[model samples]
Target: MSVSTPMLVTFVVYILGMVLIGFIAWRSTKSFDDYILGGRSLGSVVTALSAGASDMSGWLLMGLPGAIFLSGISESWIAIGLIIGAWLNWRIVAGRLRVQTEHHDNALTLPDFFSSRFEDNSKLLRVISAVVILIFFTIYCASGVVAGARLFESTFGMDYQTALWAGAAATILYTLVGGFLAVSWTDTVQASLMIFALILTPIIVIVAVGGLDDSLAVIRAKSLENLDMLKGLNFVAVISLLGWGLGYFGQPHILARFMAADSHHTIRSARRIGMIWMILCLGGAVAVGFFGIAYFENHPDQAAGVSQNGERIFIELARILFNPWIAGILLSAILAAVMSTLSCQLLVCSSALTEDLYKGFLRKNASQKELVWVGRLMVLVIALIAIALAANPENRVLGLVSYAWAGFGAAFGPVVLFGVCWKRMTRNGALAGMVIGALTVLLWKDYGYAELYEIIPGFAFASIAIVVFSLLGRGPSEAAQQRFAAAEAQYQSK
Candidate 1:
């Protein structure tokens, strides 16, 4: 559908509005706390919405919807796995981390948390964490870039390379100015926009399909198992996809919110808000995708002629169900999801370089000003590298993202979980966790079940490394043990 001038104006307005909110976030940021974690005082709303937004983003808008559109009901299992995983992640990780990170040497980065928690010397854990963050995040960030490219290609008819650059630019600009505070606050707003668009799209699509009965009939007629949540997909794929939640335990960008939180106690409220937002937004994205399949099945002529590309379901629904203004808003919501995640990943990457490597190793006495500049410069470098790598015609976004997610899960997930809960977590165990976990996933090579039993193998090895290595080896020195005791969760101020 060639949109008229009015629709074009609507699109421009939404873009301007998003840029405006990003600027607002940048102006308010001051300290590294603000830059990194929104001052650890993010209210319940911002905390919940921002976390949900950062987590969902392109995955929901493009990935989840595409899954449903292509596979039918089988795709819903991914959602079920995600919902259970996310709820557990927040319930289990958020509160403890909020208290534990601060108690353990004021960790602002994941590397900081790991090194301080395990009482490791020579900054091995820091080095490991930084490498993982840089490597996997580059791939994860590319996924967002791909989504941006999708938007430009579908709606504005831009060339793929131009679209990729545009996506990177939008994310870089916002993150460069506001940092994490800007990313989180703007995430709150973007999350709201995403939720709204998700709601509007499915509702309109269902209506256009003559309501639920008709929509269901259309889906049923096609015999697409992609719509049913509990059917069609194999057990391993379901486990592999849902296992993404395991990565949350180790994700610095997600956990940074916990550290920046004012109090661990506050997370109880954050949990309630974050879970509800995730479920509703995710549910709607699924519906939009499934409903689009039904709508398009009945009117194939109206489609944008890219059925295999399930990601287009939402955008095509917008052009079909709504006028230009509403379509613009919905499109912006998708961009918001993409940009929110890209900004967070870029910021976290910068922090790993600035805190974990630069100041930790080279410039222990560096001023906050110098540290911040280093961070900003690293962001540019990282973005440029990701852009160059992602621009290659063959770079696979969703697959690469899963490996990064799996790397974090297998590499750090078990270590972080055990490090927090178990007092005797030894340095050898921490090293083992980092090494075994990362290598298992890398070696598994993402081939299939034989490749580490499809995600479980890597996670299992990671868990084993900590337990077996710590138990079998001698414990740390008296000084190191005392350090761990001092930083244990009990040491945090109430």
Candidate 2:
């Protein structure tokens, strides 16, 4: 199973292109601010595409499709939930967060925003929130590593450990050198590649497997339930699927896009573009999995490769449907998805370590140059940890993603929403919510609450804790209320 010369060239070029973008961003990055948030200067298109790319991650290409391929249309509900959640996040959180983060002491990171918003002079909120971010994001980053390893293992016949390191190397290199701007720019390119491959491959697959009606006939002959979207969808299942949207409010990588947009005015256009891209790409992913049934039915030999690994549907389709050169580019889309999300996660983790832990506690007066290098060092450390975690071949991309997504959605989502919307939200309540929500997710999953997603219980408990704690406390400070009012006014005027 030697790699084709064309595919090797295509992959090398794609990886080099990413490194080149990092170099370009490196020249413009003058300070720690630029390294972390691109100096908050991204335009609407970059903001929208970067957010979408980071949010979707390898899960969009690998996990969702695999779920559909393995189970049925019931899995598509996750996509539906995500679309709703993303829309709500954009409409409710994006512009307000953009304004609030700036007004709240010009905070640059999520923990920074939390500590500033709560007026926590003792930095309790910052430390707790930063710790939560590190715990969940490490698991999240491992998902991306596993995804990358899977691609190399299946496509080029590499073993797991070698492929894991190979897949992680480029992302680590570029992210260490360039930081936020590099991630955002590469995300834009990767988003376009992802959408292109998703769109093109689905249409070609449908045509190759006869028309829609014919494909449906073939699918029905094998298993009628595969096309039944409501076959096993219960109330709990529906709620769990929709709960994916809750993760949007708390995802550091995606929220960074909102905070970095050049202005609040760009949010409208970004929302429209981002939603359209999400819907189309999600539909394309479903189509790939659904049509894959028919294609594999007709060619049982190729199906054997995917017998236990339905996640490889996209890869197998590309290999079988296109010529070697074109297949290489399509496969590169998978790499793009993996790198786009991995780089964002690593950068976010680095920012937490450097800004919250290192700068806030240890070196409050550190120079910008010194802070930037520390941030880069943190990236290398986190990447090594994630690579170690992903070295286990039993790791499934979706399983790791699910656990981390629930952790963030429950722990941070309610608190973030209340901080921006409810002026009564005290720092005590924010801290309580963060701690309780995270602990609930951990306990729920550890105790085998697999009947429903952890986000449902975690989000509910966290939201309740916030309300109860805020009522018991003295409430937000006068200064905090004033900042909230200012942010709301800006939102209304816009």
Query: All candidates: CA RMSD in angstroms?
Result: 2.6, 1.8
* 89-109: candidate 1 lDDT, tens digit per residue: 788777777767877777888
Model 2 RMSD in angstroms: 1.8
Candidate 1 global CA lDDT score: 0.78
Candidate 1 wrongly placed segments (more than 4 Å): 1-8, 224-231, 396-399, 446-448, 451-453, 476-494
In candidate 1, which residue pairs clash? 40-260, 71-226, 72-225, 72-226, 72-227, 73-225, 73-226, 73-227, 73-228, 74-225
lDDT of 2 by residue, 309-345 (tens): 8988888888888998899999999999999989999
Model 2's TM-score against the true structure: 0.97
